[model samples]
Target: MKETAEAYLGRPVSKAVITVPAYFNDAQRQATKDAGRIAGLDVLRIINEPTAASLSYGMDRKEGLVAVFDLGGGTFDISILEISGGVFEVKATNGDTFLGGEDFDNALLQHLVDEFRKEQGIDLTKDRLALQRLREAAEKAKCELSSTSQTDINIPFITADATGAKHLSFTLTRSKFETLVNPLVERTRQPCKDCLRDAGISAKDITEVILVGGMSRMPKVQEVVQEIFGRQPSKNVNPDECVAMGAAIQGGVLRGDVKDILLLDVTPLSLGIETLGGVFTRLINRNTTIPTKKSQVFSTAADGQTQVGIKVLQGEREMAADNKLLGQFDLVGIPPAPRGMPQIEVTFDIDANGIVHVGAKDKATNKEQAITIQSSGGLSDSDIDRMVREAEQYAGKDKERKALIEARNDADTTMYSVERSLNEHKEKLPSDVVEAVQAAIADLKGSLEKDNLEEIREKISAASRHHSRLARPCLGKRAAAARLLLGGRPEEPRKRSMRRRSRGTYAESNSQVVVRVRCIKLFGPWEGQDHEIGVRHSCCLIAVTGIQSCTAVSIWAGVLH
Candidate 1:
């Protein structure tokens, strides 16, 4: 089975969805998924056999009831659905988890042995060889009865005791076959009626019904179905090919080809856990949609209890042992305290593909603990790399946003400091000095408020140099006042020495050198509203401070405005 499954999956496939019987165990499910992985196929999803069949039959219909009575060799499932606008919505589903068409053929084989015993007094009840041959004959007749009005089953076989061989043949008419298979067909009648009742509708509401699976090919099965639904079933989709085709459609959806339709599947069973005093705490009910999140809060019942144990189950049973265990958890370090002191909140998140994640938090400390849900949907290395790259791009955007915010804040701070200083020094400073300073601060703050971060930064930077200009005039006035009040001789103002030095072959790293040059320019008379220039050297860097910029005109001490 593994090799066959591998070979089938290895052929050039874009995507695929594997289907298995609903009653399969965990080990069987794992083997099938592993086999698909080994074949290098991108298995998109796994669907239940019966549900897949319904999709294949109802994908084309805009609205109808498709009764998928699947009786395969080893498994039986009956799913009734209502389709509308390309949505295959399930109305109700029921099944004899152990019964199938093979079981029906086996029952007929037993009947044959009973008749042979009464006619000849030769019992072959303990004969595996005889039973195996009878099975083959029953299967052949069951297939033939579907088309012909009547079919005969003839078997020429050897005796089990090696005494002799005998011929056992019987004719089965369609009417008589209905009488024989009435019991098998009757089991579905109540389930269908219950389905209609639970779905809150009558058979009259269903426009057209569909039949899926090979067992529905029987003429007697068709009669019972028509009598039950009060209408003829649809034959637009083939029974045998429906399931695979439906799986293919789902595979296309996973690959993003068929996106207009959505399949909102439900959990197969109730999910809950046993709580204190042996009471069951229900987390999710049956038929609940997948990819959901639910939470439960708990607290310590007694002092010194550092942990709370959680045992999860997936069945309607009240007892934990009676239900199937999905998983368990422990809320560690719950803290030592009085009864009902530490609060522990637990969250359960189940994803669309039937995977679950658990989280716990301590309410007292507000600390969180998260359980990593094991996933079948793990990304490849390249996908991880791409995700990291996208994350880095977002980080860059965040940094840029912060930088812009900081720039505006700095502009605001600078304007605040400058405005306060201008108001306090208005008495000593000139009117133009105070007004110019106030105007610059106003423009800078207004720009910052309007999200003009770059312009704010530049204006603030320009005003930063104006700080010295403001301080120079204010200090000059204070100095003149102090000298006059003290009746003291004023010291000579410092001057900057200017010089031109040529490049040399030698360079000094530690040596200190200072040079001073003095240029004295005396104006003869005022020419063209200009004055002569006078320069002096100083020991430090010198800056020309004024409220207006002065330019040289006709080699005279220029125009100022």
Candidate 2:
């Protein structure tokens, strides 16, 4: 739900109240904010999982303790809160990091597999695809059980033979299905208690209990909620649409479409870095509404060291290693200082999108670096720009010319090797292989010595790309096999040679050493008009005497070895 909302920002949809899982930590919440910023948006406010449900319920007149139990595909968040004068302040929220409707679906699928295995005596768990189809069916059944009380799910024709033959089937009921997933559903109590305590409320204070995620629609789920809250929960809001609707409403808030509506939110978890005592020095704590900034310093750990490595971490852990490695950097070439003497002021700021922007500077030198954090496998703006520049530079090169040089080199090497291989392995290879390789080499040679550079480029590129295919029966595994066998693979020959063509390499891998001689060569000072040509990249060791007196002048064009 939050992923889609993040996308809606800065596009056709102008605002939104993104609902985060009640258990989302400050870092995760901040990361979501970062995602929003990247989309060029202002996250009006982050709505907690349960509060979003209350807002969408349209319970303006009713007043009672409410338990908003939301179970998602991969997370469970339950919050108990009150509604007074449209103020749906949450009293508390709790959840599991990895428990929800998805778990129940998986469990039910497992149960089906077990039942089938015991009856038919066939263990089908090894079939991934069959398992996936079963999982999907199980989920569908779970959803059906939510409102209808019972539904029969078809688990037909799963296994298949190479000839496309299918082999099996079954069905499941609500009570049996609930029994399979009941343990997972019951795991939400701890967080529920924690959330209520966090909000300074209890089951008695929650004026009206509400249900949120699609999983909440389950009769078994509702029974549990009612038992805990001591009242029946509101089932009015669509389990799937409430969070989205709340987000859209918040979007309306950001656009000023809804006036006099202010949403003040809090940080979700503690944020800080490891300190000397291995303690988390909390820069920001749970429930602190954001678009915030905080700064710190970097200093040398040893005397005279010129660089200090800086690693910015997230999470509420005293040890740096215990936290997430959001990013890494170094303050380079610092003035030499005594151990722990250099000061580098660093700041880690979290914007509304929850993205961290870190900056650092040497207090004495004021040398600095700044960058935004992106999760692994994704590049930051700087890296993206660098990639763009690299691509442009590569595109600027004459690919045609480059391709020609590579192709010609291929032909040259292959011709030399194939000729030698045919002589050495002639006995083992078939006559056709030898003859074909010889013919291909002849054509490549002609192409290389061709007059037109254009034709040469085209043919060379074509030949190099296709060489492996053409040079078959080159059992010797030759790089120059392109010039060896006729354009195809063949069995191993008696022997084959792979000799590199050498007069000069096709590339200038190493630069030639040269001297830069700056000179203003006086051409015709005596020819009525004095003229000088500025020459650079010249040899200076040679001394030259003038032998010029007119229209044409020549200085010693010394050739250096």
TM-score of 2: 0.57
Cα-based lDDT for every prediction: 0.60, 0.59
For model 1, residues 311-340, the per-residue Cα lDDT tens digits are 666666777777766556677876688868
Q: Which regions of candidate 1 fall more than 4 Å away from where they truly are?
A: 1-10, 13-15, 21-35, 38-41, 64-67, 80-82, 122-125, 160-163, 174-181, 299-304, 318-321, 338-342, 355-561
Angstrom error of the Cα, residue 421, model 1: value is 99
Total backbone collisions, model 1: 6
Q: List the RMSD of every prediction in angstroms.
A: 39.6, 26.8
TM-scores for every candidate against the unseen true structure: 0.58, 0.57
Query: On residues 420-459, what C-alpha lDDT tens digit does candidate 2 reach at each position?
Result: 4345445556676666656666666788776556666555
Compared with the true structure, model 1 gives a TM-score of: 0.58
Extract clashing residue pairs from model 1. 495-537, 495-538, 496-537, 496-538, 497-537, 497-538
**Clash numbers, per candidate:** 6, 34
The segments of candidate 2 whose C-alpha lies over 4 angstroms from its true place after superposition are 1-51, 58-67, 79-94, 127-129, 148-151, 160-173, 277-279, 295-307, 332-346, 361-368, 382-561
The most accurate candidate by TM-score is 1
Residue 469 lDDT, candidate 1, scale 0-100: 48
